[model samples]
Target: MSSTEDTTAQSSIFKDCLARRVIAQPALSDTPDASSSSSSGSDLDEFISYLASEVWETLPSQLRALTHEHPVIDVDADALSLATIPGSFTDTLVSYGIAADPDSACDFLRSVLRDYVDEARAPPPAWSSTRTSECEICERDVPLTYHHLIPRSTHTKVLKRKWHPESLLNSVAWLCRPCHSAVHGIATNEELAREYYTIELLLTREDIQKWKKYASKQRWGVRRG
Candidate 1:
């Protein structure tokens, strides 16, 4: 067999052996092993850092542009990895059938990253003509657009990784055009999807608060540069 085929065959055998070992093991109590937990957590962090280094630059420019409250273009791989996604990292990997080995973990992460990009590029859901009584951010009576609290771009990975409940994917906020633009301008889609998936959380940021104050004063028909 070719080298690639040989590697694939070996991987299949490894997974089969691992599955059999798991099936033969007795079920443990609900409590987890502290030492094993710590080790797995460390492994997850290392894998994320390595995967960030491998794929950070290749991420879409918009994906790399902003994080929670800061520009992330120059952020190091460690920080990028931490801010990229949220979940019980080790558990998510096992649930996805990704092996604990670094090579296997990184390979899975790369595919996840590709899915993230594809989702980010996908067209957003059709906007509803309905407008809330006011912008949730600025509290102004104006024409509003739907701002997905959990951004649509991260929907695929979020569901795949079980990071957030599926119901939360359809949650949204009504924001005036300016407020909606500011939301995207302030943070990347991943940040919005992972961290600021609610108006309360978004308002917690001082920057966002400042923008709300400024936006509230502007006339409804005014366009911001």
Candidate 2:
């Protein structure tokens, strides 16, 4: 064959190979498997429903009112905003028994809101005000501020934005001032984010109670009483 013809043939073969490779690569916008997505979502819904019946069934009667009034879907927005924030909130929600099903997630949130409203109606507990409280860390006897165990800034952007305020509240814990500051500092330092994340992930009511006991012991410099 002529050199010119040979070169053209080689170029055509190279183009064909490149086209095949491109086609074999995954499509960025390929439609998700609707059946699989729906099934997974359904399972999540069942889980959330079970959680609601188990964990929230005994919540105060007043708290139930909050859930009954709130709608499941956001009225102003056309779509949920789950894509913009950290996955921890979502993961925690699921971990705490929020179902993957939209309806189940909504019901769980409704119950949570009811609890918040009930809490709001009652007189603030003695420990609610920070001014008279002691720090959980640093052994300082100083005024306290409510520290959201899961940072409010992060939570609002993630769970509340996607779900409701009540759901966020049920998922959080109150921290004394020093511990709050230390945790925030830890969270801010990139080197410590993982540790802070783990702390938040592992936190439970028992852990909070234990921390409070430790703080109380430190404050008095003695065991109970």
On lDDT, the candidate that comes out on top is 1
Where does candidate 2 stray beyond 4 Å? Answer: 1-142, 160-166, 170-174, 189-225
Q: What is the lDDT of candidate 2?
A: 0.35
The residue ranges of model 1 lying beyond 4 angstroms of the native Cα positions read 1-132, 222-225
- How do all models score by TM-score? 0.42, 0.23
- Pick the TM-score winner: 1
Cα lDDT for residue 91, model 1? 46
The collision pairs in model 2 are 44-100, 45-101, 63-114, 130-144
Q: What is candidate 1's CA lDDT for residue 37?
A: 25
* Poorest 10 consecutive residues by lDDT, candidate 1: 22-31
Provide the lDDT at 6 for model 1. Answer: 34
Candidate 1 lDDT over 1-225, as tens digits, reads: 354543333232222222222212232111132124223333323333333344444444445332222333322232334334333443444443443544444444444443333322333234424553889998998667788999888999888988799989999888865567567756789888888999999999755764564455444532111
The per-residue C-alpha lDDT of model 1 at residue 98 equals 49
Candidate 1: lDDT of 220?
A: 52
